[model samples]
Target: MPKLQGFEFWKTTLQEARYVVAPMVDQSELAWRLLCRRHGAQLCYTPMFHAQVFVRDANYRRENLYAEVCPEDRPLITQFCANDPEVFVQAGLLAQDHCDAIDLNLGCPQMIAKRGHYGVFLQDEWELLEKMVKLAHEKLSVPVTCKIRVFQDVERTVRFAQMLEKAGCQLLTVHGRTKDQKGAFTGMADWEHIKAVRKAVSIPVFANGNIHHLTDVEQCIQETGVHGVMSAEGNLHNPALFEGSSPPVWEMAEEYLEVVQQHPPCTLSFVRAHLFKLWHHTLQIHQDLREELAKVKSLEGLSEVSRQLRLRCQEEIAKEKEGAEERPRGDLPFPHWMCQPYVRPPPKVLVPNGQSQGSEETKTESHKRALEDSDGTPDSLSKNKQKKKARNPHKTFCLELKPKYMKCEQCGNPKGSKCVFDLCRACCKKKAYKEVADCPSHGLRFKTKADRQRVEEERAGAIGDQEPPDGSQGLPETHNTEQEVH
Candidate 1:
């Protein structure tokens, strides 16, 4: 709760005051705010709006400040423009239930500001701004705060701070650039100027401008000696910047896919742009040549590119498995799985005695004969392919007929080992089979009785005094913990 200093809540403090986020209209919508909140932004402000409009138009509020926020988005501010003290106060009071504080925007510098008689145009009108602050303090129960630009002259800016302080505004946020410095090159934010304001004002001061990364937060704190830092464009590019992470790929990639699903399919251009930033770091350590990665242009393309790169990267990671020493790639022999089997079983073998003497040499001779008798050109792959012209007598000896015991549907490998309930190990591993352990979930694999038993044991064990590890807990009702009295 903010301490009641007349109308201003003097004691109310921000939770993550060390790093604050500056608001940008259109780009900084509710979706963006939620993203930032999830990514570690401590404090946030909505884009500056006309207080009069925020109070009057339902559609405007719905489109702008009306966010269906989660509980975690608390301790946030929504900024509004008001040349009139009453307008400012009413807007502030109305915004109290939804936002933590209402920031009075006296710093916006666009042509609209001049036309609306708000923002930078009102910088010269100190008394009106002061009065707006006064009414904001007197009328609104929330903390009264202001966001401003570094003045045209340092002395004049100091005077502006003094005037706002006299109006009962308890906190001031200074964007270190001046009115002339619109867009990127207006000027670098002067930590010196922000420090100057901090020295002059008794209120909490947050230094804004050029805070894009976690390191910037520290540097800004060192330079300005203000209460904290606020960033606008910087937050847009890397939302997790405050926490010192480069960015999270897996979670955000999943979110981007969700956005694509709900908000209509995004253009390939957008996905490529987003993923480019994400995979730029991935590219730094990837073994694939940069030229190979450069060809990617869409989600699918990037997916393929990222897969190829990460697959190779996985091999590198596997090399680093504990106790395993790295070996030269050239020195390693190609795996045995890569080679083609030279022998193929044939139903009959002709010996000089006109009888059967089946051996590897005869099998090799039969394999060559079968391939030679094949319809098309015999390729290197023919040696490994099953000899279609002949069948082996041993197959009947080995294969357990299907539809009884679970049997291999394709190439037979040990008939007794049923892919119970006819499901292959691969499929069972994925579908997490129970009753239908023999069947494949989709098509590629099958579940087993072992899988079902393990699942039942786990399901039974999970009840009562147990908590599942994260989301690995199976369905509650399906996993009946109790057995029959029998």
Candidate 2:
């Protein structure tokens, strides 16, 4: 059968999914996808796979997609991050049969993505992106899609979307934030940019960002006029976000565990992370349980911790019913036991005068300010650094206080302290190679002529020492006969 494209693929293959679970690293796995599907997520994306690794490593393929195939987790898209057009197409081809579509991840903004030269870092290279998407579209059995971060300018974003659409992108998921807007700087996403892209592109569009609840999902779809809304952090905290319900923490945790059991070999770390997000609020109130959750290694151990937390929450509920105790609701819209979205505090700006002048600063920023005010005093060091210095007072980070390095005898560069030849690494390497000697300290090895000759002599001696195969401790019978004939 011929593969569908554009709105046809979105409607026929994806069932026109309106609520999507965003592709998250190490968070969205088969079990989690199944749990979200049960709770009303219409579409899901696999965690972003490194395209080169996905192509090269069989273990990665099995662990991620092949090991367990759940029929319930349908309308799935496998996302890959790659800069090379051929490699991107190769990965998509490998994954195409398993999913409804293959999504090129052009939205990741982490440091890892920057170092790899893939993800949003490649957004400027429109030619490369076009080649990748076009090649995938030509080669894959399923449709090729792209998930991208918007450029700062809405017009540029619209142009980018149009470029991808022309290059044969069947669907596009626009994360409504610039590549720079990540981590502490992840402010509100600009729906206007997403709206512009949706207007410009002919393919089906999905908007991601600023989605915390079902209401936000509805609002995003209405404001941007996109076909769908994708949620990452919000979904992690509350899987039922699309269902417009905030269930209890234990309810989600237990259901997820049940799904994990049904879908054997779910990663322990993935399960632990999901539990941590689900129990985020309750853990804040019960710090002890939070520590237990972090320390626990086994699946049963994690389930046990969840059960203990449920008991504690039930006790709190009993107290509230009797009017015996009233807990303070600080910033939570719901009780700590219930699942809710975690709101990231805005990024803080550090001023030149050692005072935070912008939004509220994080603890690390406050510590930095304290250090700046102290003017290089030892007391200004962080607690951990101070403790380390206490153990060795000679140790210091101040450049002026550091001991001067000894120069090499042959070169002016810093020498290896234990060098037998008293030289820098390069100088030592040259001398070692010339002399056919080994310098253990500098990790240079060279076999001397004498050493080589000695090894050859040892090998010859061993050959001569070997007795006949008949077990006599003498020369071979043929050699003895030849000697007698002589």
**Against the true structure, what is each candidate's TM-score?**
0.53, 0.79
Winner by lDDT: 2
In model 2, the number of clashes is 0
Task: Please write out the lDDT profile of model 1 over residues 451-484, one tens digit for every residue.
Answer: 7778988888767337555755556666654653
Candidate 2 achieves a global lDDT of 0.88
Model 1 spans > 4 angstroms off? 1-13, 248-486
Residue pairs that clash (backbone atoms under 3 angstroms), model 2 = none
Output the lDDT of residue 442, model 1: 33
